[model samples]
Target: METFFSNQKQTLSRAFCLSAAVICLGATNNAWALFSDDEARKAILDLRKSLATTQLELQGEIDKLKADNAELRGKIEGLEKQGEDISSSQKTYYQDLDTRLGNFEPRTATIEGVSGTVQPNEKKAYDDALKAFQAGNLKKADEAFSAFANKYPKSPYLPLALYWGGNSKYANKDYAGSISQLQSLIKRYPNHPRIPAAMVTLGSSQLESGNKIAAKKTFNEIIAKYPDTDAAKDAHQLIAATK
Candidate 1:
């Protein structure tokens, strides 16, 4: 009977050991699965951080490019303005030279079935009147220019004579006479080189006479008809001021 009891105890011990080994194996497998999940979570977080950093770097580069674009635009605008100023100066110088040379050059014109020769004395008279006008002697300049216009209607200097006469009238505050003379200039000398100046003078006279509507019309005509001209540029500034 004692031997039977010892054999039963030994068998129970072996069963206990087998059950403990199974429990340890199962616990080891569960711990491995938990470790794998933690590693996967860490890798996912690191990938998200890298993507965010790349996006921030791309945005910084875009901002720098925008600033560079703005600077280039400003430089281009400045260059265009400088070019315009130089062109305007050159145009004025050439125009003055052309006006001076026109005195010595005798031009042919037909008037009333007769062609008359322009005299050197006529050039002198016109030049003297112009000098007086440039020196701001409006009264004498007007008298001289009027005499020239009346005496030499068929002269090649007629268009310039009429234009200068109108300017003198404007300087003397004779707005009506200025308008009449400038209107005659436009009608007679539509293709004259000094027509733009005449138009600007006419517009100025209109403005001086409290004819705001007429002035606006004249300025608008310049911008519409001769937008690339210096006269048109000045008219635009004056109109903007009025507005």
Candidate 2:
């Protein structure tokens, strides 16, 4: 019986020791599992931080690209405006140059039933004399026309100038000068359009200068040459009155 009790005690002690060892191993396993869980959580947090930092860098790059694009667009707009201004200025310059160049060019003109190419200077000189006549400055007109006739002896305006100069002299009561101009015009341009008027002026000038005989002969010549015309009628009246 004592030996049996001893064996029972030994078995109980062995069982107790095995139970304690199993408890220790279970505690150590629990600690190891907790440590593993903490490490996994820390790793997740580090990954989240890395993602946030990368997102921030991407956003910064996007903003910088947008800013650069806007600046480039503004520069392009400014360059376009400058190019337009340069084009406009060039057009204006060319237009001004063309206008200035047109002044010295010869042009076609029709003067006193004569179509011809007239130089700018020649046309201006003739127009100036005509302007003087139209302004009623008869003396200046006469001088200008006479100078033109002397300067441009072969000008087509010669016949008209002679006629106007003679009339200008008559208006100034320069009867001898008028007669001289009229006679020269008649001798030079016998078939001129001012012939009838020149004949009348000559006859009137002769009558005023106390040469009724010459006036009568001129009036008879007009009646014979230009019959049934107004000048002929005027000549008839003058001849009857003078006789």
Q: Which lDDT tens digits does candidate 1 get at residues 110-217?
A: 433335567547878889899999999999999999999998887877788889999999999999999999999888878777788888889889888888788888
Clashing pairs in 2: none
Question: Which pairs of residues collide in candidate 1?
Answer: none
Candidate 2 TM-score over all chains jointly:
0.52
lDDT of 2 by residue, 1-243 (tens): 999999999999999999999999999999999999999999999999999999999999999999999999999999999999999999999989865654577656556664556554665677788899889999998898888778766666777777788877777788788789989988987877677778887788888777889899989888888886787888888876566
Candidate 2: list runs displaced more than 4 Å.
1-119
What stretches of model 1 exceed 4 Å from their correct place? 1-116, 241-243
TM per candidate comes to 0.52, 0.52
For model 2, what is the error of residue 199's alpha carbon versus the real structure, in angstroms, after optimal superposition?
A: 1.0
